[model samples]
Target: MTALVLSLAAVGVILAFLGWIFPAGSVREIVVGSVMVACLFANAILLLAGDGVVGWREAWWNVLLLVSAVLAVAGGGPLTTSVLALVDRGNTRAQSTQKAGEVLRGGALIGCLERAAIFASVVAGWPEGLAIVLAIKGLARYPELRSPDQPASVTPQAVAERFIIGTFTSVLWSVACAGLLLSR
Candidate 1:
C-alpha cells in the first residue's frame, strides 16, 4: 500500500512537470489534474484503510514524504489553471484572459511558492503557517488587486474573483497532498 501510494505520488510529480514544460492547453491540464486527483484519492484511501505502517526512519517513507511534497507544489499549477479555466468558461474568454494576465502577473510562481509553504507548514504541524502564508500573499498582491491598471474591459471584481479562486484551489490541493504524508 505504501509502495502504491509512493508510486502514484511519483507519477503525479512527473505529470506535473510535463504539464509545466508543455504549453498550457486543455489536454495537458486535464491529464495533470486527473493524475493529481487520483493521487489524492489514493492517499485518502490509504489513510482511511490504515494499512501502511512504515516508520519515518525508513527510506521508502522518506521518499514518499519528499515525493508527496514535490507533488503538492508541482501539481497545484495545473490544478489551479484548470479551475480558473472552468470559471472563465462563462465569460468572454479573450477579455477575461487579458484581464487575468494583467491583474495577476507572476501568479504561477506565486502559487507554486504558496503551495510549497502551505504543504511544509501543514506537514511540520504548524497550521498557523497557513495564515502567515496567505497574509503575506494578500499583502503583496494588495496593490495590483486593489486597483489594476487594466483596460475598461477588465473589472476589479474579476481580478478579485480570480485571486480568490486561484488561492483556494492551490491551498486545497497542497493541503490534500500534505495529508498523504500525515497518514503515516
Candidate 2:
C-alpha cells in the first residue's frame, strides 16, 4: 500500500511531463492520463477494500473515483501553456520547448497540491478529489522558451528561474512526504 502511494505520485509526475512535452494531437495525453487515473483508482480501491478506512467502504464513492480518474487524465499542462497553446496554434519546436518548461513548473505545483488534495480526500473517502486537483491545467501552456540572452534576451539565470520554482516544489513535496512517513 505504501509502495502504491509512491507510484501513484510517480504516475502524476509522468503525466505532467508528457502533457507539457507532447503536442495536443499526440497520443501522449490519453496514454499518460489513462495510466495515471488507473494507478490512482487502484490505490483508492485497495485502500478501501477492508476495515481500514471507514467511509471508504461505500461502493458508490468507488464508482465516482473511477469516473473522476477519467477526467483527470484528460486535462494537460499549466496555466501558461494552456493559454499560449490556445494562442500559439501548432506543433512547432518553439512551442514544445516553452510548454516543456511550463510542464515542469506545473508538475512541481501539483507535487504539493495533489498530495494535499489526496490526503484530504482520503479522509473524506472521496478519492476523486485528487484527480480534480490534478486536472487544474489543460494542454501545454508555454511554447517559446527563449534562452534569456540569445542576441535579444537577458541573463541565463532568468531562464533558469522558471525551472528553479519547479525544483523547489519538488523538494517541498519530498519534505512533506518524509514528514508523513516519519510521523507514522
Candidate 3:
C-alpha cells in the first residue's frame, strides 16, 4: 500500500512537472486525477484485504481518504481545475488564459500536498496533517493569496513550491507517527 502510494505520488509529481513546464494543463490534470483515484483504491483494498495492517488507527485515516475522494470527484477539485485551465489557455481571453496557469499551479500544489498528507497520515496515524492538506487546496486555487502581491510568472518551480511545502507535511506526519510508535 505504501509502495503504491509512493508510486502514485512519484508519477503525479512527474506529470505535474511536465504539465507545468510545458504550460500544458490538459496532461497535468489527467495524471493528477489518475494518481488520486489509484491511491484511493490501493489504500482501500490494502486496508480491506486485512493483511494484518487494519486497525482502529487506520480506520480513521481511511474514512478521511474516503471523504477526500468523494469531495475530489464531486467538486471536480484538482481534475477540473487542471483541465479547465488548459482549455482556457487554448481558447479563452488573456485574463482567463493567465488565470488558468494560477489554477493549474495551485492545483498541482494542492495535489501534491493532498497525497503527501494522506500518505503521512496513513503511516503516522495523524489526521491533522490530512486536515492541513485540505485547507491548502483552497489557497492553491488563486493567483494572489499570501499578501496579494504575487506576480504572474506561471513557472513550474514557482508552482512546485506549493507542492514542496506540502511535502513537508509528510515530515510532520512522520513525527506524529514516531510518537505513536513510541507510545505503542
Per-residue C-alpha lDDT of model 3 across residues 45-131, encoded as one tens digit per residue: 544454423334666445444443333322233443454454444443433533424534444444544654555565556668666
The C-alpha local distance difference test score for the whole of candidate 2 amounts to 0.41
- Give the candidate number with the greatest TM-score: 1
Over 4 Å off in model 3, which ranges? 1-23, 27-36, 39-43, 46-91, 94-118, 131-184
Q: What's the TM-score of every candidate structure?
A: 0.90, 0.32, 0.35
Q: Write the per-residue lDDT of candidate 1 for residues 1-184, one digit (tens) a residue.
A: 6667777778888887877775554766767787768867876787678745445457877887888888889888888777776777768744464357666899889999999999999999999999999999999999988874655777777788889988999999999888877756
- Please, what are the lDDT tens digits per residue for candidate 2 over residues 1-184? 4445445645555565566566643455446545544554564555555332334444644433443332232232332233333433464544333444443444534444554554455445565664565454322322323433232222333334434343333333323222222212
Which one is best on lDDT?
1
What are the candidates' C-alpha RMSDs? 2.0, 12.0, 10.5
Runs of candidate 1 with Cα error greater than 4 angstroms are 52-57, 93-98
Return the TM-score for candidate 2, rounded to 2 decimals: 0.32
| Whole-model Cα lDDT of every candidate shown, in order | 0.80, 0.41, 0.43
